[model samples]
Structures are given as structure tokens and as C-alpha cells.
Target: MKTFKKATDPNILKHVNALDNGEITTVSLKHIFHHGSSKYPNLFRRLDVTEENLRTQELASGTSFAYDVMGVNGTGFKYEKDNAVEEFRNISMNELKSSKLDWRDIGKWLPAIKNWGTLINLAKMTYNAYIEMGQEDWYDLGEEYSTNNTFGWEEDGIRGYVFASSDNKTLIISIKGTSMGFGAGPTVPRDKENDNLLFSCCCAKVDRTWTPVCDCYKGGYSCDKTCLQDSVDGESLYYGITLNLVNSIYHEYPNSHIWLTGHSLGGALSSLMGLTYNLPVVAFESPGERKAASLLHLPHPPAIPWDKMNIYHFGHTADPIYMGSCNGFSSSCYIGGYAMETKCHAGIACTFDTVSKLKWSVNIKRHRIQEIIDNILKVWWNLFKLFPDCKNDDECEDCGLWEYIE
Candidate 1:
């Protein structure tokens, strides 16, 4: 700890000071190296880290995109698997093991990167989250996560579920997106009675409903800005409810860590909530959440490091929702006539493509969380074999245990 020094850049130093004073959360620390580099270029140059070293640093440092998670010749995204059973089966427990060298090493998590089972399970949980929202009745879930887990579940009216097992030290918060089956209009009614927990959206007549308020989230197509506040972690009423739910669960299970998963709108919410709490987050086929990140005044890329607050953002080439298939509003719709930047995608992204056979898939079908899962299942072979195998423990040891299997 003594080896680390205060950053020289004032802007970054401010956040670091806030972090020390507990004014801001740890999530604010992600991608914080620019401060050091900007103010200490000479010192940085003297340190002499090579590109190879830099690439290696990123896998565990959370500085690069998902594609860079595993170096061109390392673990993480560079890892791969085959079929559901085999994908989870042959993986060595060694891959999930953690080491001191890894920066944001979550010592005992099985779903870090290459763990297909965890990814699939979370994807399934995303489905359960949807089912929790779409089903007219609470108990109508099918092949979904059980509400009967050890500590049972907490339903947010129709917003999401907090799955907890009394014996386990980690809890999962699964969120549901825009499609509410029981609602009258396609749009989510921001009624006071509902606590404004849902995004104001409608699955039908989407174009006419006029969504997409931001760019990258581009063009400022705000879903619901009124429910939000003016400071860090000050999310809309929806996430406020989620934050409380998570806090209550955390209070009861004081020793547990939190994991978040969701699809579409839920995914976006998870990103926001995860950032708010500095928890590990994995979202499927979700849009870039600029507004949410705005509250934190998120720094440039790598705002939340994969090693610290791990976020795995999975998207496919065919998903138009996140990839801007529909595009955002015109410049006029944004605040101050300035189009909002939609590229506020946090963490390491795990973006890939599954062939979309349908003509409309470029915009719709492919964006489905199920479709992304289906593609992963369909192509279950290890993806990162392009790199050389680890000859020994020293060559491959890192806190994050992901195999770069080809």
C-alpha cells in the first residue's frame, strides 16, 4: 500500500480524495491511470512498461475492452468452450482460482470469464428476471431460478428479484427490462403508486413511442430523467428501490458479495446499480448507459475495471438495440441542443456475432438475450486457442482464473 502514491492530476486527485474520504464509491476509481500519466509523464516513461507488458497489465487491470481482457495471447475473453455440458465440464478448477498478482481478483467466483456455466446461468437468470416481470402471476415461472433459495427471494413488485442463499456468501440481483405483460399500455406508466421503478418504455410501436434519448446512448432519448437526482450514485427512483433492496440483503448477509445480471432495460439498470454499489456486474444485450454514468460523472474508458467491479457486457453483431440499429433522436431532442454521448459502455465488453438468418434480425431478433445465449451455446468451442498454452504456474498465474483455450 505504501508503494502507491497520490495521483498528481487534480481532477483525478479529487476523486481519489473523495474515495479516501468515503464521499464516492470505489467504482469511481476504475480507469484512473490517466491522472498519473498526464501529470507524471516523465516518471511514467522512466518506469518503462512495454506494450507487451501493457497488454498483459490490462487483462487483470481492467484498462481495456472485453476483447483486450485476455491479451492477444492470454486468458479471459481469449478463452473458449463447447456445448453446455462440455463447456462447464472440462474447465480446470485452476482457471477459476485466484492469485495475488491479479489486480481485481475475486478469489472464489466461478463465473469470472471463461466459465460458460456461470455465463449461461446468469443468462438464464436474465430469462427468469424477464419471466418475473412478464408473468401475470408470481409463481408462474418455468425452468427459471427458484424463489425458494436458502434466504428466499425479494420481488420488486414487478421490477426484479434478489436471489439469496443463506449459506452462500454472495447474492444475485436479477432485473427485468421493458416488457411488462400485465401493464395496459406498452409504455411503463411512471405512476407515483408504482414508485417509478420501471423505465418509461413500450415494446410495441417502439418507433412512434419515441425512445433513445442519448447517443453512443446518442441523441439524448431519455427514458426517465425526472426520477433521478444531482449527485454520484443518485439514480432514478427505480434504482433507488434496487439500491435499498440490495442494501437490505447485504445487511442481513453482511458477509456476502453482490452480483448483478439483467437483459435489455434490466441490463441497463443493472449497469447503473452495479456502478452505484461498486459490485461485479454482467449485462446481456444492453444499451450504453450514458445517463446513469453521468451521475457518477464517469471518467473516460475503463471507468470500472474488470478486476475491481467486473462487468461483462455481452452483445452480438445483430443486436440493433444496443448497436444503434434504431439510432437515437435528432440533435434537437437533447439537452442544450447537444447530443448526449451514447458510448458510455463500462467495463470489459464481450461482444460477438451469431448469424442472423432473418431479414429483420439486424434490428430485432438478434438483440434478444436468448439469441446471444443460443449463439454461445451453438458455438461452444474454446475461443482463445490462438494464444500459446501456459507451460507452468508462473507463466499463467493471475488472480482472474480464465483459460485461453482455443
Candidate 2:
């Protein structure tokens, strides 16, 4: 029986100490996600692109008993789920790859559920994926800190971390997001390449002065549909690399319940990975990947509907990137060379009304994962007693004005 009780606040120092002392089990995942200008693989796996907007019902809300799993115990956060959705929760990578050939005819991928405690824990794990050990360990580190030996996070490295519960019943894969602005590092250029490719309406084509990331732009608001599709499926892209990584992790722990979580670009990748393999995901402040998903032609369940999908996007309103308003020539994202235009996220969106409830103004600085973790989630109970409403982004749309031509 899975019982989640009220969880105590996570102690960052203790967790870090345990990790360094080998008390906490952790795995560092390193991969070269991108190839140089000419080293990219020539083979591309394409999914038949399709436009879909299948409306479906949501699961009923409920409360979970806080159960100890990762050493934290307390009354679990609010949740909603339908037991019927469980049967479709797990899918093999081979099955997914084969099904992608005719992705539109695919079966369900996620359970109809959302849990606040699970989401918060996933967020903490994602936060830990960003810790750069000796560099920013003291930069407001709490609940989750870095361990140089087991969980050392590189500011500019394209890597992931795997955490296994003490009992080995559950495993978590945390992917690192772009490390720019907060800490500009070696991976900034490649990270920006992916951010633009995945989120931008065209290819980060903002204005006349901006250099488009790909050749898909065909002057004006027109973009080559085929070219754009090919651009995202490149093996060197982070999505493909992360896909392989997740597949490997899944094969290693076939029977364990695995989850994916990340912030910003990492969050977007996590959602995409969840969509592909039908794993549960909790993405924080992720830009809408619907456009990228559409271009990639990833599979979608025909009967189950989207709200029932297990992926949950948890973010506040003060973030322009997550809100999809961080564009235009004068915006901070433009100045920083980021094209975070896609706003409609996949699965369910659990957004905190920070603008109205907390009286916070929308700002790019708020896009930082640390801001969400330290300023908001840690003191959530004091600020609000219950989790925000989690619902489908049925009305959300992306790149409505841009025209993709064949």
C-alpha cells in the first residue's frame, strides 16, 4: 500500500552530508548530447506530423496519506487520480519507438493523476540537478544540495542525475537546464541552440538583426515545415540524447517506478521524454513544448485525452518564459539570446497566481529555478494551505501567427 503522510521540510545540509558520506545512493550521468557543426548524425527518425486537440475529462481530486519513501515523511500534498489510468502508465521503449511509426494511432501514455507531494519532491530533485558543488552550494541551497563525489553538477555540462529510493522501489532522473544568466558556462551556446530549436516559432527569428538558428526560416513569417521537423530530430540534439539516456535508465530499472523532473529547458525536455515513454513527469517553469512535439510528431493517446496524462507543469505566473510573454526585441529574453516564445505546455498545468495572489510583477529573473524553489515552494504551506488547481491547457495554442509551408 502506498501511503504518503505529511512530509517534513527537507534538510539540505543533512542530505548533502549523507550523499558525501555514501549514506544516500546516487548516480551521475554524463553524456555528450551534441556534436560539432559537421559531426551530427545524418540519419533522422521522423514521426508523421499531425494536428490534434482531443478534449477529455479530468480525474477527481483527493488527498494522499503522507508516506515515507525518500526519508521525508508528513501529510502528503493534495492529489487527483483515476485508478483506470494506471494500466497505461508504463510502456517499453521498443514499443514506443515502433508505435511512433504511426504515432497518431497510439494508445495511452500517462495516468490521469496529480499529487502535490510528488510534484514537490520531483522539483527538489530537479533543483539538486543544478547544484554546481563547490561553486554555488551556498547560493541559497536548501532541502537539496550538491555532493561533489556522487551528485556534483556542472554549470555548463549536459548531464543528468539518477536517484534511487532506499528501498529501490522508485527511481528519479533529473535533467539539468540551461546554465546561463544565473551562471554563464561552457554549454551556453549549445544550450541556446536547443532552446531556440525547441521553443521558437521559427528558428529564434525575432527581428532583422537576429541570426536565425536554422535555415528553416523562409523570410517573413514563413518557415519550411520539413526543414523545421528535421532540425528537431537531429541525433545531436538534447532531446534525442536525453531519450537514449532515459531508455537506458528504464532498461536498468524495468520494474521500478521511474520519474522525470527538471526546470526550464530541462523541464521542457522532461515533459517531452514523458510524452514519448509514458513516464510520470513534474516539470517546473517549462516553456510550451507543444510546437516541438507537433514538429517531432510524437505519439498521443487517442482515447484517454490529455488532462489524464501524468505529466504536470508546476510554475508561477511571474515568469515570462513560462508564461510565454518573454519575447520581442526589447524583452530580456531577446537581449539574452533566448527565444522562449512557446507558452502552451503539454499535459496538466498547475500554475500559482503569483501576480494576483502574491502581488508579484512578471519578470524574467523569476524564471530561475532557485527563485521558485527558495522563495516559493519551501514556504508554500505558510503562503497557501493547498496546491493550486491543476487543469488541461485546452485553450492554449502556440505559434498561431506563423505559417509553416511544405
Best by lDDT: 2
**lDDT tens digits, residues 228-321, model 2?**
8889877768777777667766776787667677899988999888776767777899988877876776644443357445688889888888
99-214, model 1: which lDDT tens digit per residue?
12212323433233443434556676676544322111233211233333413122212245454432334456676664533442322442121212122121111243333222
lDDT of model 1 at position 87: 29
User: What lDDT does model 1 reach?
Assistant: 0.40
Give the lDDT of residue 193 in candidate 1.
Answer: 18
**TM accuracy, model 1:** 0.48
User: Which regions of candidate 2 deviate over 4 angstroms?
Assistant: 1-118, 132-157, 301-304, 327-332
What are the C-alpha RMSDs, in order, of all predicted structures? 21.8, 13.6
TM-score of every prediction relative to native:
0.48, 0.69
Q: State model 2's lDDT.
A: 0.61
Q: How many residue pairs clash per model? A: 28, 12
